[model samples]
Target: MANRVDTLVATSPIKCAADKFYNFFKLNMNELVKIFPLAFTGVEVLEGEEGTVGCVKRWKYIIGGIPVSATVKIEVIDDAAKSITFAVLEGDVLLLYKSFKATLTVSEGSAQWTISFEKSTILTPPPELYIPLVITICTLVDAFLLVN
Candidate 1:
């Protein structure tokens, strides 16, 4: 069978500063559950420490009103570029993809999200649904940051 590797990218303009938005994901990821209870149910540090490379986190988030979880490892953190990359180690996402990685990049006025993956089988659909999910999260976070 042929390898089905693909990438999806999406960008959204945010109200917050680039560094502040990046820091929220980099340093204060744990607070996501508390700040957005409807979108995220929990975020637990399974290995290593938060805001550091090699940290592993188990995230429980909502998709289509259903709760889904993913275990991911922090693969890269580029403060200069304001980007963080996460490798999905396991969980519901793995069921559809043989390999999966996501990168979030924040710039002066916007945030870009990229998802790279290899499908587990030809029958598996591309992760198109995640585009809106990430966009919604970005919009919500932007609003939350503006108010708080």
Candidate 2:
């Protein structure tokens, strides 16, 4: 089977300040998960401490009636650019893809802030089947930022 890499981008507008949204993802991800339990069932730190690159977090949640969990490591954190990148080491997407990396970014706008998720996944067996989950998470993040 040939490895296919796919990049999926999902953007959404938020009412909160760009910095707040950026920091939430970069620093307070665990607290955010607690605040929005509906979006994510639970998030546990599997290795290292939070808020720094190399920290790994395992996320447990349900997707389409199926219970899924994924362990992702913080790959890059650029505070100036308001971006964070996470590499999926195991679980969920790993069943199909050989590797996956997701980068989330927050940008300021005149009236509303925007959050974008750029997911690059290397598929092993072909056809992209897991992108909707990323989009759903981005949508949830967008709504969550606007409200709280």
Candidate 3:
């Protein structure tokens, strides 16, 4: 078994205020899914309370035009810091890796927010195959938020 961790820290500029973008992701995730169909096909709350710790959300998505889904349990949600962490409990990613976790942090700027996305995986094949896909998710979200 091989354990590998791939972490990425990136910042992008948005046209909206920091609070607006923060609230949209932290509070209005359902709406976000609706607006960004290219990123997420469906989002269902499977367990616990949404946005709270232990909450599980199953996200249906089409990556590379192939249907895939990931059921993740919310590990941490920090309102003050504007961050949320999700641990993959089941779904497509498990087929390739033993474990996966992703954390996204949004920090306020003058008129933009910087997103720090960190992902860790164990028993995965190659970082090249999965890392870009993870980063693309963040990029898609950023573009989606900026326009809508």
Which candidate number has the best lDDT? 1
lDDT per residue, candidate 2, 91-133, as tens digits? Answer: 9766756677777777874112222222334324432334455
Superposed on all Cα atoms, the candidates' RMSDs to the truth, in angstroms, are 1.2, 4.6, 4.5
Off-target runs (Cα >4 Å) in candidate 1 are none
lDDT of each: 0.91, 0.67, 0.63
Which residue runs of candidate 2 sit more than 4 Å off their true CA positions? 110-148
RMSD of 1: 1.2
Tens digit of lDDT per residue, candidate 3, span 7-116? Answer: 54444445555666666655667664666577678988888876578988888877666788989887877777777777888888667656667666666642222222
* lDDT-best of 2 and 3: 2
* Candidate 3 runs further than 4 Å off: 110-148
- Supply the global lDDT for candidate 1: 0.91
Q: Number of the top candidate by TM-score?
A: 1
For residue 106, model 3's alpha carbon misses the true position, in angstroms, by 0.9
Candidate 3 global TM-score: 0.71
lDDT for predicted candidate 2 compared with the true structure = 0.67
- Winner of 1 and 3 under lDDT: 1
TM-score ranking, high to low? 1, 2, 3
Worst 10 residues of 1 by lDDT: 29-38
